[model samples]
Target: MTRSTTDEAAVPPLPSPKERRRLREAKSLSEKEVAAAVGVTRATVRSWETGRASPRGRKRALYAKLIAPEPAVKPPAVKPSVVKPPAVTPEAGAAAVPEAAAAAVPEAPDLPVAPPVPEAPPAAPPADPPPAPAPAPNSDTRSGAEAPDERRVSPAEAFDELYARTAPGLVRQTYLLTGRRALARESVERAFELAWQRWPEVAVDRDPAGWVRAAAYEYAMSPWHRLRRTHRQPDAPPTEPGKRALFDALLDLPPAYRRTLLLYDGVGLDLPETAAETEASTPAAAGRLMTARAAVAERLPELADAAPAEQSALLHDRIGGLARAEHVPVPRPARAVRTGSENKARLWTRAAVAGVALLIAVTGLTLHTAPTHYEQPISPPERVGGVPPRGGPQKLTAQDLKLQKSLSEQLAHGPERLVPQLE
Candidate 1:
């Protein structure tokens, strides 16, 4: 007879607990073991196999895949069995085998012979355990693989990329603040160099660029830079007659106030960020900006009289023109002086030479005044006990005589005896 074909061929059935147990056993696993692998209880697996319940959702899909038989290669089809058996009553069927065999039926392999059924049904169902907790975010599973593209790049590489992208803007910002192209370049380059050194730490910081800018501003305004500036005058060429008034006005302000104004108004940083960058309190930074505004107002009387847009344009032009002007580069301090070790060595050599000169002078004076003989002249000794010319004992003072008398009197009296037996 031709084998019956059905819609089941197109849509596979989910595995029953018994089927799962059989498959698991064929693959060397028990019902409870398969249940544990699928993160469900043995009872749930059992219910599914017995046709008492059905597996659902992702779990059902997993169950179907686990127990589905491999497709057969082109093998000869087998004929159905010809033997027929008498229909038994339900009670008779129940009494065919022991209860244990029924329970163990789920674990049986798909062998030719069927196991006998039990007289009694299996025991009451086991209690349902609590549901498992949800998996944490981004947890990988056994079958689920991570995508290659999601891997992170190294911090150094990332910092290098960011530096390349932002360096020009950062240089422009520095130029606006200092109005000196060389100083701007030096400040921006130094800041980036320091950032590159600590890229790992800086990469993790919330605002790495801001941190760099702050560091650059601090380095530019340091006492060392101030001292260097004091020795060498700025070489910025005289501003043209049109911009001369504005240039002088800006130069007149202290560097701290100038930085605050430039960062806020010129570079377009908000007050708080400008304050933080300049290491100034917000109020102080605001006051500096106000003072800068007033100074600009005095010099560019047109700004006070012009519309707001005109005033903005005028200020920008003045600051931008100053930045474009050729200013004398602050020469990198001479390498020997910058290193400091050479100066320190020279100082020590001078001190050593002075110490040696002092020592020699003292020694020479001592040698020049050296005594011919160390022994003092021996004067004739005073007579003692009428002995002739012997060295006499030291003379006693009046106070010594009194002390001697008291000691002599006390000794002469013999130590006062303690009173015999206290009464």
Candidate 2:
């Protein structure tokens, strides 16, 4: 059913029941129509029209207009004929009235002027009711019928999800490298924190977690880790004797060889990715992987002839099992996850503005500080045959003199003289 709106205009008064029924019958209007127009229920209109009740207040005014007799319009009273002293014959009595003289006459004050009839108020037609106040917005998505089937992932949401999914695996790979649960956790946590710091950039990246995992890998392999003692995870009890031997052998290799093996095998990254993580060329990474595999094979004969893919699969299982056994809590974001993304945008904008200001300041200072006047540009004091002199007790700094001496030695003894180790 359609709704209705309230009218601000006051509703007119209704007539007595007998008069109302008479007017409604005369107009052949339905009771419902008259009731709607009068802004009342059909029952009320029927009661008023059937001599059972009388309309009151604003409704009375409205009903009166329909049924009450109109007041007679009075003719304007004529002014007593203005008789001039009988000016006749050739006198001015015959002349029609002049415009100015008619205006000049002051009408008798005693003749009361009729007031203008006031117009009827525009009818307060019933308004179509306002759409039932639009429902209080459904704030709780779960509370109302508007349960979202899906939603677009916000950048922060997407980044947090990626972190949750990848961090444990990343920490495990780090564990394989450092062989310490604490260090691996520390490294992965640091990496995730950096990712959070630059999440805006990381969120749009094809591999958001790749940079973090790579960074964590680097962090876990720091020289400081050498000083810090390493230990097998207590939670991840080494069961198989062969796996224990493999883990021990992995620890025995140099960091470069071990890191390559973990990146390629344990992390299941390809050659290029492994290379990038280790800061090596693809060939270098492959060579290092080969070296690490050979070294592992020396300890474990089963892997000596195993295919690269098979070996990687085996290492992944062993490492993944260990990583999953221990619960390394992922680091929570400090500032990024807490504040709104808009704030991060504002920070970057502020930094850009500051950098621009600094650049302008530096440029101004450089221009202000530059020498305005100089006697002449530096040149050789003497020239021979229009060529600048090279050899002299010249006004030059010690560094310039040293460069000159080195050049002389190179020219006399060839480039070989500069190669001290060869000599």
Q: Write the per-residue lDDT of candidate 2 for residues 1-423, one digit (tens) a residue.
A: 223222223444444333455455556566677788878898887667545678767886676665655577999976655433222334223334444444444456765422222232222334455485555554453554544675667766776777778776777677666667778777877777667777776665546677677678777777765564453332353567776777778888998989888778777777756665565555788999988888888887877778977877766776667556545655555344335444665788999999999999999999999999987878869745977658877698999999989887775643554545753
Error of 1 at 106 (Å): 42
- Judging by lDDT against the true structure, name the best candidate: 2
Instruction: Write model 1 residue lDDT over 104-199, tens digit each, in one string.
Output: 444435444343444445434445666989876577743666666577687656766666666666665565445555666677667766676566
Global fold similarity of model 2 (TM-score): 0.41
Q: TM per model? A: 0.40, 0.41
Candidate 1: residue pairs that collide = 16-49, 17-48, 17-49, 18-49
Candidate 1 ranges with C-alpha deviation above 4 Å: 1-147, 175-181, 229-231, 306-314, 317-423
lDDT at position 165, candidate 1: 66
